[model samples]
Target chain A: MPELLSDAFEQVQRDVDAAFDAFLPVPQDTRARLVEAMRYAVIGGGKRVRPLLVCATAKLFGVDRDAAVAAGCAVEAIHAYSLIHDDLPCMDDDDLRHGKPTLHKVYDEATAVLAGDCLHALAFDILTMPGTSSDPFVRAELVATLARASGHEGMAGGQMMDIVSDEEEYDLRQVTRLQQLKTGALLAASVEMGAVLGKVPPEGRTHLRAYARDIGLAFQIADDLLDVEGDEAKAGKALRKDEGQGKQTFVTLMGRDKARAQAKMLVDQAGEHLASYGNDAQVLVELAHFVVKRDH
Target chain B: MPELLSDAFEQVQRDVDAAFDAFLPVPQDTRARLVEAMRYAVIGGGKRVRPLLVCATAKLFGVDRDAAVAAGCAVEAIHAYSLIHDDLPCMDDDDLRHGKPTLHKVYDEATAVLAGDCLHALAFDILTMPGTSSDPFVRAELVATLARASGHEGMAGGQMMDIVSDEEEYDLRQVTRLQQLKTGALLAASVEMGAVLGKVPPEGRTHLRAYARDIGLAFQIADDLLDVEGDEAKAGKALRKDEGQGKQTFVTLMGRDKARAQAKMLVDQAGEHLASYGNDAQVLVELAHFVVKRDH
Candidate 1:
């Protein structure tokens, strides 16, 4: 099972990388700066969590795995764009992302911001391209899902909260609400998109939703755990930046030990959703474990 | 006809204003900053060219006028978002918008950036909400159109070219190419979306495209003309910022008289395309004239 999961993961990564490469625009002389910035932000290193969810969720439904791969790449483009904008000098003001200099840090903030804007548009372009989805309705749903997830009630809304809540003390409940929209909404959409695009039954979608929600929370908790316990070299972020920034986080809300346990419980629930799919979702299960177990 | 146009314009304005007021996110204490930035970027100013295009195009198909109004407001939201981001300290660094302090100037740059992000997402949200469109496919197409227009090949890409081409000399062909994507694409989408959502025939879409393309260029050229001839208070921008920045523009390439002639021809061609829609498209003709004839 472990070997099979590894193979699937490797294949998913290759497919996503190729799709992204194909979708990027040519960096002509006049537009070269913008294109270069976009390429730098997107091609920059990260786990590709959203893409993996898209592919894995589609694969579970036994549908067009290629469509899933394309969608996965598209979602990642949006994710990368968000990260680029979030790290601008004026926004989150981060100098680094995924352990490397942020796009603005590497290539001026204006380009970084515009590149992120382009990537957001590019995600929808990928989802709605002529051959990407044969069913117009499905294609439309794909657009709707992605747009909603990326917009006000989803990631953007969460970001607004994150910026405003910097100095405020929020209880775990409020923090979780923000995290659910900020981090978890897209994660849920990643899974839901795979299911819907693959034409999975409603029952299957419900289970996957549960699975994605658990994994999403678990992923954030694991991130907090890493911030507390991991290294600068491994995590590519300052080890205690969250604490130093006076930001609210799961680790700060629940003690370190409790956060770790919560992560484990959520991962366990994600696994429980996979029981009906059995070995078919082996990669997804391994991914859940990887989320909780990773140092970074 | 002028009185009727003014009446329709006023009615559209009230309805659109009401639409925005109805749909805007509540200014809760935590998210007040973001909400304020969004309201500032959207309310009280700008010509509403894109929104008017949406309204006129939808009117051609005899759809409920309110649907067009909703779409108009949504696209304006997107256009407004783009303007806010463009004026950010890291981007254009402009201090003023619509004769007032820019969003980033009034609020912090971080809030301004996030406001742009949130507004972009909100446009999609408005277009996709169940109330926005009766057909799910129409909803999807609206999402897809705005996304494509906003992405790498559209406004974002155009902005990139504008940034990179500042010092370089590009010929008329290259300049027009950049203008088409940067400004033309979204304008085209504005008209095309009305037709698409209204279920206008494919041939009608073709006609609308030609109309939109011509007027879009005309609008840009007229903008160039305004830079040369209009007052600073009226234009809400420092006159000749284009020349000062060493940017290429239509007025720069052709003399002011020639640019005006070119704009008039385009406006005439845009009006000609409405032959297919017959008397139903009077509003569209007025809109085309407004694009070329407006002072601000």
Candidate 2:
């Protein structure tokens, strides 16, 4: 990775962490157990790739940095909450995340559930906070956009499909549809929300959407690649479990070599969507490449 | 109940059910399993009291009935999601609700979690839908209000407290705070969202808030009283379980006679908040009384 791009990623990660730490309920609050669980899951963890996308996209249109961070944190909170829930015994039942005990393991199952639930609600609250924007209409747009991405036909719907995938055989199209819902939706929303924060008009949004859509798929393929042959220490998770589960993955169907080539193609294609923005969108162009190249 | 009040309550119930039927994802969708779980949990259960409260309060300010119903369903969706999560084996772990099998029992635990999470996201989606309001600010307020009521300081927080409640003894103030968060928050938001839809001014909101606050306690006490005294067939779930769990409840903390009396007093006090509205609020006043009177 280039120094400048790597530095930008670290900076956004720090910003998002600070935003999360500052916004979370006080440690001494009455419901501190759940709040503590929320903080544990969200802060000091993850790649912050989603927040980087928000920050990078918002930068393209000169949105205020703090407002963008607030928006970034909102998306990251949802991402974190989804991870916490997804790792539940009933779901993925993973024991570790970001190199630490998962929320349920650290705090018990009930706290984990409430922590995830509360964090989901807190994401909307953070977006609507005065710091995000002076205009409620803009906040409403963010809420509507994020909620749609997170709800049925989006992230949650996709998760359901993934669960059912364990029972059914799915062709490439079905797999793509499942991938689009399970992971792509929120990835798209992160970029879309940044555009919303920037007050970018409808036509301008299409460009960002196009960019998000490509990167989202590429990101997933990269994930599959990681699962097939990732260093668990670097990734902070159990890898190769997809193959162990006897599930079809990019590597399973298209072979690792082909999947790697496809991811590169997607990263390159994603960059084209940002062509009209030129110099203003350099960070986003860098991010598209980063998504496929990240070790974790 | 008065004849007119009973008829109004039935109308609200029907309106909420019809609204839910219209908004839920189609049963034939690719990921219909989760969506189907959401529909089963929401459409065929509860007294729709939260929705009715929203409709009744919005009617006070002459808001459009359908728009009010949209807001009503938004709160109901949140309520439904909370119930689904609360019934998880890690949480309340009940097998029945509203005379039907709980979601996790009917559909797998994973489906229940996703359905609950998805329904939660859908609540915000419905509030922002064009059908809810033409005003973006109102939609934003609705989003903010519902999110706040559902987050750490609200329903989710309350759920956490309930889980923790088993570990430690609680006094009156602690118990009051717990009840306020677990149950009071959403009930309060139901009325508050309706006021937002009706475009009621801040001062007018105070009265509605006062009514909600009083009724919130009364409602919980009524539930406790039902557990101790009411029929299981009509209530549609286990009763006296709070006692079995040795958890502190209004009944345990205050004693049944005192708890029952306090509930009646709260209902009467709730009615006092609406005195200024005269005949326009007659239904709300009667509804307050009915809450304490209902068997289920």
Candidate 3:
């Protein structure tokens, strides 16, 4: 990784961890277990890619650092909650995530469910906090954006498509739609929310939106590639399960080499969309390349 | 029930149902099952107490009826989601809710979990929409209030306490605290968000807060009492489970007679707090009376 992009990732990880730690203090009561489970799930995992995306995008408009970090945390909270719920027995039933036992494996299923729920609410809670942004319009828009991205029409809806993927054979277009909703929506929202925090109006965000859209698809394609080829030890979760489940993916539909080429193509296109910002978007351009290249 | 409160409940039920029906239109794809589960959980069940609370409280400040109903729908979304999750096999493992088979029973566990999560996101989505409130501050505040009320320190935290209640012998104080977080927080938020939509400042909401607090406890006490004595057919769910699980409750701690008397006293006190609003608060006062007096 380029030093600038690597430094950005490291800084976001530290900031997001500190923010979640400060945000969730375990009570000295029976609720302690719930908070503990929530902390366990949120405090110390994931690539912090969403936060980095938010911070990087927000940096384009000179948005406040703390406010950007707070927004990033809100998006991460949604991401974390979804992972917890997705790993439940009734869902993906995964026992591993980020190289550790999943939340439900570490805690009971009920605790996992409640903790996921608490984290879901925490996302909105963080967004509406004055620390996120003093501007009510910004805060409201942030909430609306994240809510729509994570709700039925977006991430959750995509997840539903995934759940049914096992029972039905989906073509490339259907798979693209599903991945767009499931994974692409949140990624796009991360960029959009950063732009929102920067007070960039909807019309001024055309390039940023394009950049996000391209990277979102590139990221998912890369994920499909990684699932088929990456090491579980490095990925920190089970891989190659899609093939085992006979689920069609970017790799399956397009073949591994073609999918790899497509991911790279999308990433390059994503960087091109940021060309208007010139050198100011270097880190974003690097980040786009990293998305397709990342092994995990 | 008094005509005023009964009418309020009837109106809220119709309005909330209509709002949910409109808000959640099933898609024309794989996502349909998930939306179906969400609609099944939300559209046609429950007493709509939270919506009534929001509308009644908003009425005190002459807040727009449609906006209040939107806010009410937001709160109801949270309530419905909680019930859906609480019925999951790894949670309460219930097979029924609102006299219907639980969401997981009717669909599947995965659908129920996803539906619950989707509804959770829908709550914030609704609150931030233009129809909920045109003022950005109001929208932001509504999101914050409901998020806090439903998150770890509120409803989910209360649920955690309830999950552990079977093992721990809780006293009245502990039980009260648990109930306050679980049931009281969201109920209080209903009134608080209503006042928020009406642009009532925090300092100006003391009486309203007190009214919510009193009725919140009264409502729970009535629930515990009903759990012990009410028929399952009337209650629309499995009753007496608290006793079966050996959990501590108002009835278990205070005994049935004292619990009933205390509920009545709290209801009377709740009405007193709304006395300042006089005739305008009559519906709220009747609702308070109905809290302890209802059979279900």
Candidate 4:
């Protein structure tokens, strides 16, 4: 990605953070614990990849940047909620995330669970705020899209598969299918949501989806690579923890080198989707690269 | 509270069971175990109160039954998910529900957690199906409304309060506030969604909100009353368990007689909201009575 585009992405991230920080319901004693948990989970620093997709996809289609920001933040809320719950004792049981304590580890398990639940609901609430979407029909479509991407056939199902797939052997195809649903589903939705915001042409929408899927897979592969490399500080959580847990991962199914090669190939395919847009997708191009190159 | 209306409510209950039974995705292996747990949690018979609200609201607005059935199903899915998660080992730790084994007790804790997560997502997925809502804007609104009602400001928050309120004394006002958000918010949404579906006037919508709110409180109050005099066979889970857990219940805060009197008052207020609709709202009237008078 170009330096200017990188700077622009950072600005968007800042704005998204500011919007969420400002708009969340005030601190009331009745819900003080829940409110605190939500704040911690949401504001805890991360790469903000999903929000970037929403911003970049909207910009690619020449829509108002302001319009995409709220929706973008909403998607991030869903992403944050998933992470919080995924790290819970009854779920993945991780003690750390993004180089910080997991929500459950910081607050109590009950608070973490409630925080996740609230965050998921808040995502839809933000997207449906009065005057957020230009048309009610469009707003509905966005809501439906986000819900499908986050729900049973999407993220939740993938999580179920991931849990069950642990200790089981699987080929690349099966692993890819699992990752697509678990990780790629929301990424695809993030890009598609931007297209919906801009009302992109059918062809453009299709290409954006193709781009999201390719990069989403690449992102997971890179994550596996980082885990194998023992990049504990950068990668966060316990390093190589997947192997110890017998979780079926790209690095476990495919050799580490092969996983890296596959990630490169996926990124290349994602880039091919942007050829149609020429230089308009500079941020997305950089994002694809960042997804693979980052140690964390 | 007419006899004919009560019969109509019973028919809706049957429809709810059939819908959940038919719509559950077939489980595969471990997933099957998890899905089965979800099915057991949802399929266990109840009053189907939320679904009834959806149907009744839709009918009030003159929307086609087919168009509104998805929304009805979606609300129940959410309600079921809340129950499953709430009954987990870390949460309520209940071993029974609807006179059967609870999800976590029947399945493993991890599976129970995932089942709840999937079911929660499933509710969103069902609501957002391609053709579920003809008007996309309405679909978005429904999604947003449900999220709010189900999230921090509504169900989740209510639960958090319930947990905290224990070990502390609370007056009737505080109890009312807690119950309003817990059960009342979603109940109000059920009526509002129906009105939204039927394209009712703003005044009519307000009336539905008032009706739902009043009945929702009455419903909870009656529930507390039931715990005081309930049988295990009729009430599903253990009765008086709330007091055993040191829960701050309405009956505990106020004498049982006072609680019953308050419930009756709320039921009367709920009935007044439907006075404008005459016989058209007979089912809702009966529902209000049923909520206050039911033993289980």
Q: Which candidate comes out best when scored by TM-score?
A: 3
lDDT of each: 0.81, 0.89, 0.93, 0.81
DockQ, in order, for the candidates?
0.69, 0.84, 0.96, 0.69
- CA RMSD, predictions in order: 2.1, 1.2, 0.8, 1.9
Whole-structure CA lDDT of model 4: 0.81
Q: Model 3, which residues run further than 4 Å from truth?
A: none
Which scores better on TM-score, 1 or 4? 4
Question: Candidate 1 chain A: worst 10 consecutive residues by lDDT?
Answer: A1-10
lDDT (C-alpha) at residue B24 in model 4: 83
Clashing pairs in 4: A136-B137, A137-B137, A140-B140, B57-B194, B61-B198
Would you list the clashing residue pairs of candidate 1? none
TM-score of each: 0.95, 0.98, 0.99, 0.96
TM-score of chain B of each: 0.95, 0.97, 0.99, 0.94
lDDT of 1 by residue, B254-285 (tens): 88889999999999999898887887888778
**DockQ, cand. 4:** 0.69
- Candidate 2 or 4, higher DockQ? 2
Could you tell which candidate, 3 or 4, scores higher by TM-score?
A: 3
lDDT of 4 at B126: 70
Residue-level lDDT tens digits of model 3 in B16-84: 999999999999999999999999988989999999999999988999999999999999999999999
iRMS per model, in Å, is 1.7, 0.9, 0.4, 1.7
Which is the better candidate, 2 or 4, if ranked by TM-score? 2
lDDT of 2 by residue, A143-240 (tens): 99899999887999988888888788887777778888888999999999888988988786988899999999999999999997889999998888
